[model samples]
Target: MDCKSESGLEMQNVCIVEDDDAVRDALAELVESDGYRVLSYASAEEFVAGADATQVDVLIVDFRLPGMSGGELLKRLNERGMRLPVILMTGHADCDEVGLGLDVQDVSFLTKPCDPRRLLGLIGAAVDGKG
Candidate 1:
């Protein structure tokens, strides 16, 4: 995508780091429909390598992946000083276990098959600095 708003201005960037192809694609569609520029990756490692972590306005990531978990990615980003709004999701029952001791601000959690309205609301809040 061109990452531009309808008014010919630059739009906010939202990144999704998910290993599941279907989940990632669906999330990208949802986020894009909300008018944010969406950048997606299949793994935390791919996201770390392919995109600048500091530039994205918000990050929506899966808590569990084949390689590095979402919590680890958040920790690594924190260590690198890239604090931003994050929405972490997972199908596992141990949702509370994610992002326990991370210094990143504006963090929210969502279970798998999350409500689109709630997700969009969180994204809006994050973008508006209310998260």
Candidate 2:
């Protein structure tokens, strides 16, 4: 799970935006274990304020956040010309509900309680530009 390049620098960055502390921590741990650098935030606003979208390889976000829904965040990113691979995870909503205002490419949806292996696979595929 060493995702560093030949020079020993991390090659992939994964950002997780989830409002729940437990979920965010668990996701960060999972993604980090797979060798990707993980930066997590409790909400989309926090992510927007702290993260540099250009450095992100993949974004895993919750559909409903405390401030600025995941779909709106993606829209803003898209408007800024930052089209990164995104995985939208939700516990109560489906794609139709979450994608209402979303307009971006290289995006996928995963329901809550998503299989860890599937998430890892999606992250790998996203980093490889095949997801």
Candidate 3:
């Protein structure tokens, strides 16, 4: 069977839930450059409503959001049984506290203004189900 989707998109897709347009676009560009499909959302609600859990290989979310935070979103995804790998980005000094007990698997945190290489590496790891 072919791995690509019916739309001819790559099989591996990364869902980015970020409210910041600049940050979201930059992440999407970087992810796409690595040959993976990118699905970006302005809010966790939008992501949850629009994204297909089965199609997403990994999730990249911002710690702070307009309504539901990244941790809350992670919990929501878990409740839906979509245990995709996750990466959380934030500028909050206590971002770790916000994500203390998320129920998802293979989760990692990235501080805001994260190094491009680090972000790429983290995404690569998540895609491979390692981190």
Candidate 4:
């Protein structure tokens, strides 16, 4: 979907990297309703392979995946000089543990089943350069 604003201009691109089909679809719906372009991926590898740094403004990723983890993806993105704001979600009690040894910045953490309002607020802050 094209990220379009009310003034017929482009909006920030928000990517969702979620392995779970249900979660990915749900998030896409919610974020799209909020007017940002939603690019949903089933895995971090797909996102890494297909994402365009110039277009993406923020990322919402699942922290735990079947293969590469969210921290690894964030590190890879940073290594590639993307530097987009990110929100990582997980069920783990200590999500920060995954970020150990990573130089990731402009990142926020969210537990699974996060409040929709909170997620939207974070995305707004990230897009506005206030994250």
Error of 2 at 3 (Å): 11
- lDDT of candidates 1 onward, in order: 0.86, 0.86, 0.82, 0.84
lDDT of 3: 0.82
Put down candidate 2 lDDT per residue, 51-75, tens digits, no spaces.
Answer: 8887788999998887798888888
Candidate 4 backbone overlaps, count: 0
How accurate locally is residue 20 in candidate 1, as Cα lDDT from 0 to 100? 86
Q: Write the per-residue lDDT of candidate 4 for residues 1-131, one digit (tens) a residue.
A: 44567798877789999999999999999999998888898989998788776678889989888688887888887787777788988787756576674555678888989999999999999988842
Supply candidate 2's per-residue lDDT for 77: 86
Off by over 4 Å in 1: 1-7
- Better by TM-score, candidate 3 or 2: 2
Clash-forming residue pairs, model 2: none
Query: Candidate 1 lDDT (Cα, whole model)?
Result: 0.86
- Please say which candidate is ahead in lDDT: 2 or 4: 2
lDDT of 3 at 62: 92
lDDT by residue (tens digit), candidate 3, 1-131: 23487787656778899999999999999988987778889999998788787777878999899999888888877887777888888785856476566744568888888888998898888777632
| Model 2 TM | 0.88
Per-residue CA lDDT of model 1 for 19-48, tens digit only, reads 989989999999999888999999999999
Residue 77 lDDT in candidate 1: 86
